[model samples]
Target: MKKLVYSILPVDGYYTFSQRFLELLKSAVSETFDLSAVIAPLESVFLRFETAYKRERKSEYTAKLAAADEARDRAYLALRHYLVACSYASVEGYKAAADTLLSILKRLGWSMQLASYQTESSRLGNLIAELGQEENAALLTTVQGTAWLERLMTAADAFEAIFQQKLTAEAADTNTSAYRLRKVLQEQIEMSLSWLEVQQKFNPSDKLTTLIGQVDELIAHTMTTARANATRKSAEEEALEEE
Candidate 1:
């Protein structure tokens, strides 16, 4: 019975709202009542919207990125510890070999992983280049650490590739795509309801009443969610300002 408050619904909340609406009308929809054609096209858009949603959220894409970064960090730590642990090696030149590499690492002051994605990538690249220099290459060879260097390089490169993928996905207008799709669904739902309302006036039925009631429930839930999100965002902003 109630109309959708489209603007109040957040971008992330729009897909599920339309989805629930679709399930409600699936049995009763027709060319007369829902002439706005809300089902077939909506199903198609859902696929794209789902992908955009994943890209926009910190779920699948972000999880993979995080996993890659963790792997690289582990590789880096392994290499670092190997060099440091060799400082007291029983072999004569092992300590000297480690000292050569440790001097390079000591200049870093802090782990590059503590930096931002791009910053860490750049620093790690630079560190790898410095370690691969002709003179340092001999020291790496002496300590049997060329394999360690290769592992770090492999891990860092993999992380950078995933980071670049995340960047590309972000640059591909995923947010805008999601917003545009949500708006289309919202408009179609409202238009479909208008036609259904007119049909109900000419030919009253309990079916229409039940369908309207379900839609009203969805609207109520969506409104409550929007209001809660707004309140949370406001509180967060206030906290940041106080800080």
Candidate 2:
């Protein structure tokens, strides 16, 4: 019979950093658990608080309290569901919940941008921690943590619309073709960088950055080749005319 021994050793003085990093991840998981276990069951208490506050008012208190209580309950339910949705085991489940929450917020005329920002921030934080783990890295590589990425891409598409609008306005303001072209190119480059930054924040992988650099080099090379071909064609045409 052979005896097996399992040993754990610290790697490169990163033991403390690794432990703290894992703690941060565990803390986020703990928050989800706390919210589901503790905060979720307090919806009734929130409604009761709303009712009590409404009672302090003297004018049409009954209807007012009823409306207030209803709104409070709705908000409470939304928050609970949002948390539950975020804790879902799959990205599809999470997105379904997020979509419902977004619809509710939109109907209430709330700021969609704020909701998107918070959702992206939380998802990105958790995703970064998850990707740090060896087992989860492959599982989550293609999974989107939130709808914020889609929102960002949609916004990027809108940049084209904005550029067109600005170009039209600029045309009306001045007829400088050179200025318009330069402005459009500058704006397009800025928008592209902005989109790239958003993608990098969500998944900060060196491989992705390297891929982008490679693509850029390929584009530059293609442009150089095209320019050379054009110059050669012009020289050939001039020689033919001389002959």
Candidate 3:
């Protein structure tokens, strides 16, 4: 029986048994004991050591998982805030937004969704390049300014698409889609305001101002039309219930 138990003892268990055997010999110099007496205490010491090691290992693993989870949450929040900042195209605001995005990219570089971050970063770089070109022009002609605006708008659309994809992944519901649509519209309006401010400062002209006004009016009309449609649909549903 003793040989059978020894054959199955793990390496660590054997080490624990040897250490306990020395302690037992020192503490019981005059005592006479059978093999069972020594084996019992050795087994107890091995079990205690094994339980403690497992508990400590579990604690370390849990701490690592918690830290990872917190990092992910912080990265997500930073991304959202960066998008909000990017909606403002002032020179100072744009720089700040870019910095925020770059920081998030660096922190989450090893994330499973690294490709998504890279795509958004590339879009932001393109937008910044277009803005730089506009700034460097000696006199931004109407056609040239319009071209820059178009490029920025395209980049904004792509950025919004990426953001929507993230939102959908987090909350795959009808309300999530509606919320994303509203957010996109809000971002467009904010971006238009920022562009208008730039044109007002550097390329002041009635034509550009009128164009910006028309864009704002169009957005307002679209919102009014959407609300009316929703109201009509609700009434129709109520009438059907009455019947």
Write the residue-wise lDDT of candidate 3 on 4-101 in tens digits: 13222323333443344334433433433223433354445444444544443344333543344334333333343334455455654455545444
Per-residue C-alpha lDDT of model 2 across residues 67-171, encoded as one tens digit per residue? 433333333333334434454546654555445443443454332211222232343334334334554333223334333333333443343344455456545
TM-score (C-alpha) between model 3 and the true structure:
0.24
Q: What CA root-mean-square deviation does each model show from the true structure?
A: 15.5, 31.4, 32.7
Mind sharing the TM-score for model 1? 0.49
Q: Candidate 1: misplaced stretches above 4 Å?
A: 1-55, 174-243
Q: Give a tens-digit lDDT track for model 1, residues 125-228.
A: 88899999999989989888899999999999899888777667656743644544666666666766776687679977777777777878987887788778
CA lDDT of every candidate: 0.71, 0.37, 0.41
Better of 2 and 3 by lDDT: 3
